[model samples]
Target: MALVEQLNRDMKQAMKNKEKDRLAVIRMVKASMQNESIKLGNKNLSEDEELTVLSKELKQRKDSLQEFKEAGRDDLVDKLETEIDIIESYMPRQLTDEELEQVVKATIREVNASSKQDMGKVMSTIMPKVKGKADGARINKLVQKHLS
Candidate 1:
């Protein structure tokens, strides 16, 4: 099923099960997707676009979790961790280190990225291929490692 359709179905299930925390996270995700759709003039988002939205939400939750940890708010940290886990269920399986390195190597070869100066070129070429499957920071580090 499409991401939006899956979200709707899961939302209903959450409501049926009276999972308040899970339901709240689902609603937040749906709202963010709708906002992105509105920003794009109300067009239905493609799967890639939906994944982008999901990834953005996950990133926000992770950042919040980090801040909460630093501030010693274990309660909020746990809540955010739950939300992050819920969001992650909808994302593509993350790439393993070996897989990521292979992709980076292939991209480096494809783009003829010889040094750090070609990091931008290599990243631009590889990101679309790995989008929603790998973290940008991780990809950047791998790219830098290969290039340098």
Candidate 2:
């Protein structure tokens, strides 16, 4: 089933099961996906597009968790972390550090990049492969380490 359809089915199941937290996260995902679909002037979103939406939502949760932690608001941080886990359930398995390192090395070699000056080229080439599987900040760090 499509992401939206899957979300709809899950929403009904959550309601029946009285799963408050799961329902909330699923509702948020539905709203975000609908908003993106409308923004793009389309009625349906491809699986890849849905993944992009989920990725953005997960990133927002991560940012919120970081800010909450920095401000010493453990309560909110705890809630955001829960939501992050819920959101990530719909995403593909994340790449391991070793796997990410391998890709970065191969990408750098493909782009013939030996310095920071070629960072953009290497990143642009590799991001599509890594987008939903790994965090961009991690990728940047690995790229820098390999380049220098």
How many pairs of residues in model 1 come into backbone collision? 0
> Which residue segments of model 1 deviate by more than 4 Å?
none
State the C-alpha lDDT per candidate. 0.92, 0.92
| Structural similarity to truth (TM-score) of each candidate | 0.97, 0.96
Best model per TM-score: 1
Candidate 2: the clashing residue pairs are: none
1-148: candidate 1 lDDT, tens digit per residue: 2898999999999999999999999999999999999999867998888989999999998889999999999999999999999999999999999999999999999988899999999989998999899999999989888777
> Residue 97 of candidate 2: its Cα lDDT?
99
Q: Using alpha carbons, what is the TM-score of model 2?
A: 0.96
Tens digit of per-residue lDDT, candidate 2, span 1-148 = 3777878898999999999999999999999998999999998888888999999999999988888999999999888988998899888899999999999999999999999999999999999988799999999999999988
